[model samples]
Target chain A: MSETPASSVPRRVRDASEAEILDRLLPRYAAARGAEVGPGDDAAVMIQLGDRYVVTTDMMIHGPDFRWAWHTPFELGWKAAVTNLADVYAMGARPTGLVIALAATADTELTALEELADGLTAACARLAPGCAVVGGDLSVSDTFTIAITAFGDLEDRAPVLRSGARVGDVIALAGDAGRAAHGLDLLFAEGVDAAGVPNADATAALRAREPELVAAQLTPNPPIPAGIDAALAGATSMMDVSDGLALDASRIARASSVALDLDTAAFAAEPNLERALRGGEDHALLATFPATSTLPEPFRAIGVVRAGAGVLRDGAPLTGKLGWDPYTAWDGQLG
Target chain B: MSETPASSVPRRVRDASEAEILDRLLPRYAAARGAEVGPGDDAAVMIQLGDRYVVTTDMMIHGPDFRWAWHTPFELGWKAAVTNLADVYAMGARPTGLVIALAATADTELTALEELADGLTAACARLAPGCAVVGGDLSVSDTFTIAITAFGDLEDRAPVLRSGARVGDVIALAGDAGRAAHGLDLLFAEGVDAAGVPNADATAALRAREPELVAAQLTPNPPIPAGIDAALAGATSMMDVSDGLALDASRIARASSVALDLDTAAFAAEPNLERALRGGEDHALLATFPATSTLPEPFRAIGVVRAGAGVLRDGAPLTGKLGWDPYTAWDGQLG
Candidate 1:
């Protein structure tokens, strides 16, 4: 946690040399488990477990991706790592190493960067043990940005692809679904001032009102272990539920050329079924298995694959808004 | 190459959906050689050739890293790939895959993105055959940013680290040195208008006047293949010469806990020895080999390792302005 600064302000990035910044920050990020050569080299070398590996990349920008007033730097770093790690886990692989490129304005405080590094290491320690930042780059930019690439080891198991679903396969879900979306809606409606600017006091009040929802939106804890469990339990197909359950399920349906029929009664216990169907950024694991196979722990049956296309709810066409698309949805508005 | 517009501007990124943009751009980036699942899945699965792998990352932002008037989209993409590939090659490894995260404004033209993709694949084809873009992410930002993470196959060879150099080793150079710095000087002195804005006509005229220098600055072709050769020929220590020769050589000396003595006569044929000694951004290969071993064809001996600390020119301590540090060097100006 950072101390509340006085009027003079704390030391900024521009005040320190690049080498000084690295000397202060690199030690905070834990080294990767199997890295033959870690940071301070031209490249980091990692020991491989099998003959195949999985890699995924994701980016989070200051404007469209997040608001500084609503989330701390630690949360941003944690979410950035979690997003890419979820992608690797979707393939039933254990994450091994990560390479991050962080771009920030010179006026930004060094404490913010230090907290961000702390958050990255904390997430890896809690979610996927043995995975850590192995190498990274830092640069000055007009906009603050965090770009991460995660690598994983398969250990000889075949990758679980979204196109492998078969007719009569049972669809299963792991982790929270609609909570993050509900939290975002709450933040927009009540956590901002009259001018749509995020207010610290207002955000704190909103978090107090809905702790679980706010936490889910700020720091999601996806079922990372369940991905490998589902794979080992004979999953036919798998994906990360990033762009809402319906949209991501539709992707699996289209990729496999099959229809997914969800039972509305199955999710009746969810606080908000609509948000669960149409919200985004939960990063939960969505997987399909043979009808005869038992569902993996933490994974519950939600739908079944049929001989058709598109997504269905209770044997009818599912419609309305699906998910977030950064290209078309962003309206040039900052936090 | 993009055609010069007559009057009306081309379609901007905001006009098309995310899916539409991906459909137009993904095909231009060729598939990675060993990718079992490329681009479409949550993560890409790459077949490993050995029990070890190399990874590195680098970032290029529009304001601090490049100017649109001086660099075309193709050149930006090519240089981005080349920079990271050089780091992998510095470890004596063969690059195999890259995952890029690109963030640009909504008003950016689609042709620019297309050309960037073309340049990425073209660089792979020319510099490191069989390596290609395998996965990536896109986002909207106020500043254009390209963050790339490159992966390489070690294939049973030991990685050449900068800390392995010993006394009596012969230091060698394998690529251009100071030419890019001279090209940068030309751009700043003659390729800009009165207001310090980069002028297209002036840049073209400068390129026409000095083809190789301008090319080295904008589109450098580093000695990627020579890295593997040096390793095969028993390189003791290696590094990618991103900073000036003197500054980067100091890094090797410090890491190895020894001194390096450069012979000024070795580079007597250079057009500008000062730039060669103090300019950066060449992405050349600098390595050390045993005194008894024969130097590789592309590698020419330039100096020798001595039992001391720091770098020296003709047995004297080397001193002057060395290289660049983005955190302190950028002045918040754009072309």
Candidate 2:
């Protein structure tokens, strides 16, 4: 959850027509490569590359996923787009285009919605350079909701699946670890109540001191090119660590019928090592490569793939809380 | 603007964990072609044909788009899938796969969600022979929301865009235009109160008398094959009449820089001409072809594309409210 306050603009969605909202937000999505027909059509037409395409969808709801008090509409949009892009990259594909489904209360400020659109396009331009927000649907609901679909082109490389990890492979990671998880701590440390209400005074003070950590949680800039790079380097199995290390690593382990043994000593030099191991939304790629292969830039070996099951920390069985599980993690109706 | 009450089922979403829900719903999706990684992975991998792909997304919210009392979970899921498939066909593409993003309050019944999943797979099987729900995300929200992405293969045929219609082309339509609109009226006349609440007593009476009309509104089965047929028979321009005939026709008119004049006389033999012209969710193909072209099955001449602006009803300017525009059309935050 976040504490990003609602924008104080006067004209809300209910005040304008749907056509007006579309007119205002549509311009934010500029044309990108391979787009034969762009937004404003019944559907978008884009050129697919090679013989395959990679696709994924993700959602960030207001209460369970974020709080307006902690994120600007722009940041929320950016984070939503970037995190979803991380998934495409996780599959060893180059992020291509997107279609967004945005729902909010009728009283939501138009400026807020525009800021959100700006954030989406801004992330596409910065993180996935060749991608664009090609299509979207807008509607009114009781709370803010965003469902984004991201597509990717694998070039000529075959997709790397989580089930392909072979025993004797070295497990590596690309991008920051545990940053978003710690970022969430900083958010809650601002004196957030169990009900998720943010104390304005604490939030403002934290904003002054822990801006980077807060930004990390609000607008994660995961390494988008690493997945394709890993695939090019012959990655056998890979996935984005949105669900933290041990839990996600176990997923790969079970899928590939291999166990992942991580060395805690590998993180002795890092601060918040626990967060790195337990934080979800790290949005980094966890991949397995051939044992003797040289790892790519910004990627380092963190574990080894072996014939077994589940995940191990320093060769010991991993247990306890490791990440967010929207269902069990939060009790009852969050919003 | 609906009057249906909430479901009375004892089990709500908050009662189960996400894993449990996934366990119950995943089995309904089964499998499909081109999906190499499928669901349960970080992202799904699928093969793309030809050089380009057609993509579109649609959203359905609880109150504005549907009501629990008015339909079943299966129908809701099926409607969402079928309507989106209509969009792919509108672009003259055969749908190959889909990814759905569904959100509902934690208190929502798990059974409802499962029924929805069943509906999605059922629609894919019936309307799109080889299509599958390849990927999806589940989240908690204040209201039920479903956002679906449907991708299609053009089979190397150039996409027939709305901008391709030319002056002197004849406008033709496949599938029923106003079936859904009249269906809505049937729902309302079943003694829906001002709060949009359905009177259960009246609902049962109307259901027994007008099952087909109610089904049209709740589960529109558009002629999906008509889109490909129109494209194969040399359609110049095309679109699905989702937001009523007049409004959508005007959209093509604006895109193609041509005026469309519909001959009401063409509907003299029809029973629901007004509903056909003014109802949204008709989920039918509206296209333009060369005047001398031989049209295929289910398509009939309705109007002509000519030099001018806007849509005409029997040579007269279209007036009155024509279709849905959620924001301005309804008041307050629904659902």
Q: Which ten residues in a row have the lowest lDDT in candidate 2 chain A?
A: A1-10
Q: Give the 10-residue window scoring lowest on summed lDDT in candidate 1 chain B.
A: B1-10
Report iRMS (Å) of candidate 2. 1.0
In model 1, the clashing pairs are none
Show model 2 residue runs off by greater than 4 Å.
Answer: A1-10, A191-196, A199-201, A331-335, B1-11, B191-195, B199-201, B331-335
Q: Write the per-residue lDDT of candidate 2 for residues B1-335, one digit (tens) a residue.
A: 12233544336667666767788888999587767768888788788778888889999988778877787899999999988999999999989889999987766777888899999999988888888899999888777889999998888988889988999999998888787888888887673655667655666677789888888888999887788888898999999988888989988999999899998887887687777788888788999999999988789899888789889887788888867776666534333
Off by over 4 Å in 1: A1-10, B1-10
DockQ of each: 0.87, 0.78
Q: What interface RMSD does each of the candidate structures achieve?
A: 0.8, 1.0
